[model samples]
Target: MRVGIAILSYKRCDITRHTIEQVQRHTKADHELIVVDDGSPDNTQNMLEELGVAYIRGPNCGVVWNKNRAIYYLHEMRHCDVVILLEEDTFPMEDGWEQAWIDGAKRWGHVNLAPSHWPLNDRIGGTGTVSNPIISRYVTGQCCSFSREALSVVGYLDTRFRGYGHAHVEHTTRFLRAGWGGYIKSGRDHNFYLIRSPLKVTCLDKPPPVADYSKNGDVFNSIRHDHIHRWCWRDEEEMAVFHTSFSTLSRSGIPVPTISKRQWFLSDNTDQNLVWDPETQVVISTPDKKDERPRVIATVSGETVQFKVLRDQTFWMTWEQPGEALLKEKRSEAATFKLIYGKNGGVGFFYNGLFLCTDHNFNDHIVLSRPEMKNWEVFHFSGFSDLEQPNNNPMRSDRIQDWPL
Candidate 1:
């Protein structure tokens, strides 16, 4: 098989260089290497040049877009029998990794080389000294191998998953539906190592550039608006059995107004005034020192919930008590969040049960690091009303600019 390796790279020059160096050092088989740069304005181009590797520079098209481009380049452009996709953060851990994946690809059309929990089956042992390949229901694209024939069957990776979520599952589901089996090759010494993702910095000197909150939100809502139904399984209404609605919003004879405006909401009912300042908008600035930080408090049902609207377009919920005290206290106290609905009655702030609670001190907030909203993450002011007419821009004259960041 004519094997090709395509690395989807952005920012993080150091990590990208390390990943390339590792791939070059470990792989013993003869295969072509391609690096697709997603318009990262860094030393990425120069670094790839210094390393003497094949690369293509693309616009800031996002994760899935670049991934599809990589697949296209390797499978269609290069006419390879199989293409391997790797992110700058993940790289092979052992020699002959390419050969192992190529072998696995022959058995199963798709092979995930990264170490992740088996989607459907438990980890199985290989031989007395080797690990066996385990079948997976869904596999991420991080370090996965796909054959040209499999791509022909399942089609290319959907570039519509433009940002950092669900592309793996969506693509994997397609392969599964086409009767293509996905597998995990074990018995190799840790096949891959996922290094820390580049630190987000606003400065130009930083390796990877960080997009501002609004731009990030635009990308996020774009993906969520398009593919959320598939991600949340909205077609299967029977799965939403976890929680009940708030009595006030449900029973209030307000026609359960649909999310009409895109304004941010605070839980406090007493503060009717708009919280945002037009002159110097909320820039998501953080105090240099924790001790120097001013106290942030919001009242919900007469009790104070320590909350902060971060610059990244996500809110944080925290508690002042210690770990043990935090455990003993009712989940209602810290977790009890008031509805921060938009003017259109759409939920501006909510949590996804899947990616729940990123820990910053004792705070738990939705990880807005990515663009797609998890199934539990979305809610409507009028019970899925916002979702029904997602693109609708219902105007509310009374609404004011409240999203500070």
Candidate 2:
């Protein structure tokens, strides 16, 4: 496949030159390099002429506009099979990097290959597939690859997105909705490096003036508003811990939620019976409630479980149980019974310690009663699977061996 590399450069001549050198050294496929100079004051055009690389120059338009212009030139003027976009700061690490994207495009027809450094921990910020491409509705434009078909269908980046913003995300969503497949290939480890410079100097030289999002609020607002499912910590303390955990997992590109003990809870009356050992990555919760009656009224094994906590408090567990028929009648009548792990390692209903085989299936609900606990708080856990053996798997627990990392 014919691959074209388009690097969007502003005033950073040194970084742009380095990126070009790296691409030439690592890429094995036949490719043409095009650098779009967005009216840079620096000697960028002169350097590109010296390096013998094709160039496109335009008036001082915004970054997104410059990017769209370059893409249009590559697609309409050059007629390349695939276009790989990179910023001056990003360099490729792997040999045959172009081939990886070409191969991916052959399989998925339209794929997005991004550099490894793109943050994936945030649901909205990772490499994704077309089936559920975006955990949240956002995509990074820093470094990405696109097949010719995708470019034709999605067109160029929306010019309304002026400075650095949601232009790429909006484009990706449009492509996915049109029945095209997208995949994120982990770019070479050392192939691409984000040029880290002093923010003060960089910002002063070319400060990103905030755009009036309200003016083009319709497009920007739709993307921002659709991202409500993206997870957020309730407070500052939780956010700090999340950041640290996220940083560690980011190295391998495996996306997971940043979980914390603060977000977990046990019965209020218990003597801190919930044990969490970070060193071991295990959590053990031993019941301390004396009433011991089942709090769940009904449970649908793979769907939902409705149970009472305090008289006014109710808890819902989304999962399926095995023996549901026995409890079907009791569930309809609002019978009180606790669901617990049975001796046979299956779901069992319990009332006062004797495993009660009630007509209603009460196998998966764990009942607890704490009169002092007034307000109910939602505890967030990652790696929850309704199809898995234990539906409510703890995030930081060794017991959850089959949990996806």
Candidate 3:
């Protein structure tokens, strides 16, 4: 894969130059390397020019902005499928280290290639290969690589983070929520390490920039977001808004919930030959063609589950009278379902003690507000054959911010 290496450097001219040299010598891959000088005051600019490496010199824009510049330029402008970000202090130790990073990024959309903290245990290999990914939500941005697929979902770091602090953690959080697998390289040939002290300029023409942890920390604390089951993403639930409850699909990747019971997913009708008729307010036989059917999104709030049927327009399934179901334009009076899973795949709903089951023929209609769920449909999550509702959620893509230079 074509990799774009983004080397974020500052006033540490000697260290930055060494880093550039090492990367150019060891990284054996088809890649473009660019250095972003975060307004280095020393000889960093001149030294970069002397080395003949691609470098951008601008006013000190802090760690977050400079790193984003590197990412956007290399990933978008260069059209590189994968972008590997590295700090000047972080240097590669192994030859062909970029290959491992590329593999890690391809395997897990986002991967951290940072070195092991303790120097004594510096050799990291064996189980940490890309084939065997160790997934985690958090990853260090100091020396990391992200596939283009990941950048689309999580976007770049929040520009609000002035210099540095929590931007790495915050950005990583969004990527995990977006369904991109996050990984930290613990495998063989993993060769990236951090220099504890990469900056030392006592006698320079100008002083280098300093980081303000308090300011960055404040910004991070001010903009806090929670993606538990509500007010997070479209994939969480509240469908589209609790956004999509944490995610209805199970680890099996099937349109089923991980819990004992699943909610309703209209797509579940195909194999069972059953579908919910939004207009008629009943479960009917699945149509031979699916294009004729409309789009449906099931949402859950508090303890009630609501379905959004999109055809000519948005409509909600409502019960106007006992045993009479219809679709309404608004959800203010939409019908809700409570699922009750049976021993073998049978499930019933519960608002109070009310439950629904098919008639003696095990067909006829769906909602029969009764005393107990004696006749609850087996695994069939819809009407007619088994009007059971299973869990299925959705995800909405995040918009990227235009952090103007």
Best by TM-score: 3
Give the per-residue lDDT of model 1 (tens digit) for 259-293. 21122222111112112222333212222223222
TM-score of each: 0.44, 0.45, 0.47
Candidate 3 lDDT at 154 equals: 67
Tens-digit per-residue lDDT, 242-296, candidate 2 = 2222222222243323331122223212222222222332222234434343222
Scored by Cα lDDT, where does model 1 land? 0.45
Error of 3 at 379 (Å): 66
lDDT of 3 by residue, 281-390 (tens): 57543435453554344444322456655566767876533453467788887877654333223334444455543433445344545666554332233321112322
> TM-score of predicted model 2?
0.45
Candidate 1 vs candidate 3: which has greater TM-score? 3
Each model's lDDT: 0.45, 0.45, 0.53
Please list the Cα RMSD from the true structure of every candidate, rounded to 1 decimal place: 19.4, 23.1, 19.7
Q: Give the TM-score of candidate 3.
A: 0.47
After superposition, the stretches of candidate 1 with alpha carbons farther than 4 Å from their true spots are 114-132, 183-405
> Of the candidates numbered 2 and 3, which has the greater TM-score value?
3
